[model samples]
Target: MEGQRSKVSSCSFVSYCFLFWVQLLPLATGGKVPALIVFGDSSVDAGNNNFIPTVARSNFEPYGRDFQGGKPTGRFSNGRVPTDFLSEAFRIKPYIPAYLDPKYNISDFATGVTFASAATGYDNATSEVLSVIPLWKQLEFYKTYQKNLRAYQGETTAKGTISEALHIMSLGTNDFLENYYTSPGRSTEYTPQQYEDFLVGIAGNFIRKLYGLGARKISLGGLPPMGCLPLERTTNVVGGNECVSRYNDVALEFNGKLKKLTTSLNKELPGIRLVFSNPYYSLMHIIRNPAEYGFDSTSVACCATGMFEMGYACSRGGMFSCSDASKYVFWDSFHPSEKTNGIIAAHLVKTALAQFLE
Candidate 1:
């Protein structure tokens, strides 16, 4: 049914790219990915922040201005986030609802749900800094969701469904920003290299835990080039308008470690399929050549001052915002606009999600 989507230019020409895949879903045997369950931070969060007490909330105007019905749903983008469009690729649903949203119907669970929280990360301390849900708590919530699913579909069916579903885990960026660099608790103990390894080790254990829970197709998003984001540029870019080399080096190092960890996990866990979604490279593609993606503004967000305004600063009563969000790559200082999210996800489906779709 996803192919039946109208040629609405408001959603853009890039969306049409998925129509071919959606049409083939019914004909494919195991080729079609059954579901897409997500876990991580704001990059893929739908509306989990609405239920929690955190400044990372995006459940307001301008955030979801381009989404269906024109209402914000806690997605950091001006429209659908990566998970929403990616779900459409599988004909999973128009959008995958948040796991914590009480309004989600029982049937919604059959397809997929996102368990990500804005600003949370692998380090418990990182989440603690923002009062958002910790990675550990998100896992507990997943256990609860599993029980609910079993209750809804009966144990046998739920088991089969979960085993076949695709899982997306994207976290750790905030660990570098909120913990490793700023928090005395972390900086006092480990060097940057040591901290990256520690994060990777803990994250690897988390992947193993998910595998134990019947997640056969698990994909993890690597850290984006944080230094290339608008926020980083505003704060750290020198006269040349170039990315902060130090931060990018850290992201590259962490991504390398992540790839190795996932490879080892795939080898150790029989029947397991682990994918590494390279947000770093995907983002770099756009950041390096914004014109190729049809974006005009990459230096500032579409909301507020667009320079440093994010989270609490981007509000309705105060600062101004751009009229057209599509032209911009970022919706805020730290998060990409919907168009950019779609571009990044299109790359992910071709690269990281290929095995799952096949």
Candidate 2:
């Protein structure tokens, strides 16, 4: 694959973007959405990790060279993330602001904001490993955001905004990666099936909490083909060019159960539109046949070593980055490139979110 090279970018963390179309550009979509409120991990985190007391932040070079101003914004991708694209799709704003960002005033909260923290997960132990925000803590931040919204916009308008906003969750990946697989404690305590059930329960509880917070339109992203990630490929026991089937088995099991959980929640929780967005289908679709999707490499990343380096390791002054990042599916060992995120977001909007659109 073209991603095996170890060259890197030479720019600083504060490069001014010459292109206006990167952030101000309007993306096309059929659905009319008011706002996008996002939660979960690095996948959807705009800059929540930057404010957090955690080293899991991506506020460094090469992290956002493709972003609005070509400056790092604490997103782990090569550029704009899924929520940014989803915001564009909804015509809410070019980028969803982080609630913790003091620079943006209350008017910025008119459209929804992101409460996601990079490296966070359903399990407290998962976030403990990385010293980032946990699921429960993220919920607390959501509560604070809601309180601010009510203060910023009168109670009635805030209530309507909370009910009408498109809420999205990109969680659970770290619960597996950082907890089940990496943590020796979890494996010793529970089997694979037991762990899956535990995480599903956590997810269910979180969704219920969101419903209680007046979130009506909720879309949760299921686990991707975790085995196919470059990091997983390198770490998987069944090594070679093939993906780790056992890891994917874990993800598949989780996705099926997660879908069932959402279905049950939708049936029981009256007036809540819960959707299980299975990213596995879209991710694997590109992996199995990269050429059709215009991707040149699916097994390797565009930054650093491509197989195992990311975040600080993928910085501009560190290792080599691909000349054409769009050709690769992954921006780093764990995160997808902006192109791949756009593709998956577009697919989800059309297939998953479109169905529930009013």
Candidate 3:
């Protein structure tokens, strides 16, 4: 009995020591573990869209008015996007490169971040709406990124070199916004529920691809309330300032299906961490009660046209511009302001990432 007690005690002591050393790993090293690899649409795009000739690009005036030197780095927001905030909160640098940017080379991605440009959606049709980077293309970029990382760090070290790396994904809104609802090309093809399933299937396939690519930490995002966007609210719909319940319902259905898929993925692919950030619920709550979140104008874009009020075809030079970008919740018809993105980043960092990072 005494011998058994001693063995158990020794095992417990060794486990405690191992955990203690693991906890001290970051602090003992002195420098932070760097590198963030982001993949998503406008929400997390740093400046990849600038390289593309798409009309959805945001590398113009009023886009980066809040950045370090007030230069539009191609982010859809006035300043740093969610990826920047997430990197900052994690104590890494803020300027991550867009994977497609010419200035970015293999070395730039070693310590910095990379945003793959795409109107990226769970559905290809949604990706085609604006000719943004499709999910497959984004995965191809990741393949290139991995190759570059391996070349720089060598094969053995590169096996899982993405320590502390976070794959921040913000997509699927375009699937509903452009494909199912607005785009004439796709609207007639699938019912709203069919579209949701199609998107979820795409999402699942994308996640599986990421898992195969050694993406252990993935933050998949759900759609925001589609009906609440200023463009959606003011469009040809009969209602005034009312969110499109049908679109939101589709999003809800997608979220439910996505949750189930995530559960299955976690079980099937052990050691791969996949989390879904429910921005839909959070954004909807804030939009419905702007005062609660300190947002003064949740329904309008701070840019010239102010939401869909400028028509579905509003641009930077449309009509008017707000003096303070922080005062507004959205930068354009389909994008959120830097402040709002920061808020969402904070929530993601605090909630979705709490378990993984710690």
Among these predicted structures, which one has the highest lDDT?
A: 1
Which digits, one per residue and each the tens of the lDDT, describe model 3 over residues 109-208? 8765665664667677667777778878888878878888899989876665664456667788777776666677666877777777777787888888
Per-residue C-alpha lDDT of model 2 across residues 109-134, encoded as one tens digit per residue: 67868888889888888989889888
Q: Each model's number of backbone clashes?
A: 0, 5, 5
Note the Cα lDDT for every prediction shown. Answer: 0.82, 0.80, 0.69
In model 1, the Cα lDDT at residue 2 comes to 15
Better of 1 and 2 by lDDT: 1
Pairs with backbone N, CA or C atoms under 3 Å apart (clashes), candidate 3: 118-133, 227-244, 230-308, 231-308, 304-320
Q: Candidate 2, 191: how far from true, in Å?
A: 0.8
Candidate 1: which pairs clash?
none
Regions more than 4 Å wrong, model 1:
1-10, 17-31, 237-239, 316-319
- Cα lDDT tens digits for candidate 1, 17-97: 555545655455343677788899999899999998888898987677778777788988778898888888776677889
Deviation (Å) of 354 in candidate 2 = 0.3
TM value for model 3: 0.85
Of candidates 3 and 1, the better by lDDT: 1
